[model samples]
Target chain A: MNDYRITTYEPRHRGAVVEFQQMLWQGGAAGNSAYLDWKFGANPYLDDRYVTLAWQESELVGMLGVFGSCWEVDGHGRVMLPCLADTVVAPAHRGGPLFGRMLEWLVERLRADEVPWLLDFGDQPAGPAMLMSGWTAVGPWPVAVAEREVLGSGEGEWSAREAVRGSRSGATITPVATSLPEMPALAAETRSRGSVRVVRDEEYFRWRSRNPLARYFHLVAEEQGTVGYLIAHRTAVDTDDGPTPTTIVECEALDDDVWRDLVEAAVATLPGKVVTMWVRDLAPAREQSLASLGLSPTRPSGRLSQDIHLPKLVMRSTGVVDDAGPLATLTSPDVWDMRGVSGRGWR
Target chain B: MSGSHDVQDVARTVLDCLRNKLFLDGVTADTHLIESGLIDSVGFIRMFVVLEEEFGIEVTARDLSLERFQNVGSISRFVIEKLAEGGGSDKPAEAVRA
Candidate 1:
């Protein structure tokens, strides 16, 4: 094992951290630096920046970050917990115990602070390792995709244009200039099912809209007040076919018909070739709405097969709380309201 | 119901996958795959796919433990146990030998 020094992130280490994330961010240091600041600096949940770094002498070799997130557990109170994100190791230092060591150090620190639980919205590539490290895998949450080609219209451009203008449901879908002030009310009114969900207040909406990594579009359905709303963001993803423009619906109205109309309006106006969102099983109405919009879920061969590349909610107890009361609720997939909880939809 | 021959076949298939898919050579049944960082997350998933296809076994969330995949020996033992539990095909191990 190499003798690598592990330490917490300090402001002086900002420049190196930004440079280290360039490969991961792909938008150069400037964009990554801004993103880092917005995520950790302006965050309302936690005060200190919780980033762990591994250094081989003076060179930064690996990094793991934890950002504060607020979750509202039904019947239970709200708690601010850390969500693991931005895990990266330099290419030259790949295949080593550096990542494990860094993770160990971070977990230890969180444990010392008496954090009850830790959450991770990691990709499939990191899934097995997280599972091995005692993190409970929640849902592999199937994602629904809407593609222009799948509509089977020879006049692809015309169909999408028509989708934007065709609102037969009598709901007026208008693109909002900024994050809706009534987002919290709208969310509260729509959410009837009891589960743990991110507290999507005005503060969260404001912070989420300020993501420097992607461009966001907010559309609201106003009958009297804000009846329903949809938040979608577009970002470039390097697929096998090269960098393709991908739009992800981060959050939407829970009402089926409203959701369908919001999605239809957004898809027609969004510039991306593909638009996707996480689909939970219990919401048959939401599923029907997506189907109505010509979106279909990508079928993996098996749940545990290698074809399973979707992100899952992984969690672990910090061991600070002896009671397994909260952990039981968290581990159950059915108890999670996972919309916009993924923190930056493209994770 | 699995015998020594079945275990050997499973081990061989695992070794072949380690070499072919992960580009990991010189691995023994007792060699450390996870702790030594010989196989990464991507490599682990690739090996997973191969084991599922070769053995016609379903690896579930409960099976995703470090102890089950720590090394070739452990993996072979797990596959054999799963096969005995009717988790995989009843076909002879020779048919799926990598």
Candidate 2:
């Protein structure tokens, strides 16, 4: 008999989500409150694509959510991960193979869907699972800050045509800071992998994009009110590198050439030499867009971490297939889904 | 021939910097930088920049470990002393990765 079983939630059971949260965080009100806000608050952006819970002989062993999101680069944007904001293992079930199993289960789900995401589960539980799977790793995209302001403060942002304005004459790009309302409809049009769930909509949009720690920006190109390519700025973070204005290109349809031009246009508004913006990998278009602008990605050896306390709360063992239909197969979308990833914020 | 910042003082400073800046909403100096919700791998590059800029030192991509930047306090202490030594980054590739 299977002593341990895992269940991946459809949509998200906020009640179940909260209960699991309370159980995992035994540190009382302060710790629990902080944990909840961090996972599901304006201050923190939680992805709802893959949320799961584990059980060991009727005990709620662990639960976690694999939050999928879209990121911006110079080119196209697609779904990726930002938070692995899941709590694993009840304190009583501390030392067992539950942790590895939970992680394996998550990986199998991700692999099945063929979706790529950044693990944000406090760096502890994720270390082992990533190692076991040997996934190709990327960044601690340096979080830097410019003399910044709160996001959505109605600031006068750099215009998209600021690209052409800063560059050669007759540049055809325009940067638009979209109203919070547009995210959902645009997100609904997004393409994604398998049966993965997304938490896109207006309310989440306003909350996720408007947080103090989060920074978002977008680029759009139009020839005659007919738009072509667009990109998103992920969350803004403060670091000793000063501060960085970051963007995750959530989705893009422009061919590589147009994407490259757009990147050149975008980089003009940045703090020169300081490297305030850290655009993550998105469309293949960004492959050269960043390079053309004299910008380069920092290279580093893989960073690793391991869970000390909540091992069982991490992830599950793989090969246990989901009972769903074709939607269950985990293959990434050919086109990036924007709202599903905070909508057009990144692309 | 020690400089203005002592080995321990360097540690303290690094800890202080992390707490003052990168600490997420619920994070503090005592919180483990890696194990906490403060950062991810891509975020580490920025961590490096912060260490260099604020501490007036250099942390090469080669000088990385979960131990070095494990906690706010540990990262500070390590960087301060490393700075006193000219901030030279000549650690062997093996040691940095390990």
Q: Using DockQ, give the best candidate's number.
A: 1
- Cα lDDT tens digits, model 2, A1-347, are 23788877543444445566655444345554444444444232444445667876655667765554434322223334444654566766544555656766777777676544434424353343343343322233322123323333224554432544323323366666663344355555544432343455565565555533334555655444323344445333333233334444343433455555555654544322243333333444454355556455442322221112111112222333343533223332322222233222321
lDDT of 1: 0.70
True contacts kept of each: 0.42, 0.00
Cα misplacement distance, residue A130 of candidate 1 (Å)? 1.8
- Model 1: runs farther than 4 Å from truth? A149-168, A236-245, A299-302, B1-5, B89-98
Cα error, residue A219 of model 1, in Å, equals 0.9
DockQ of 1: 0.33
User: Candidate 1 chain A — worst ten consecutive residues by lDDT sum?
Assistant: A150-159
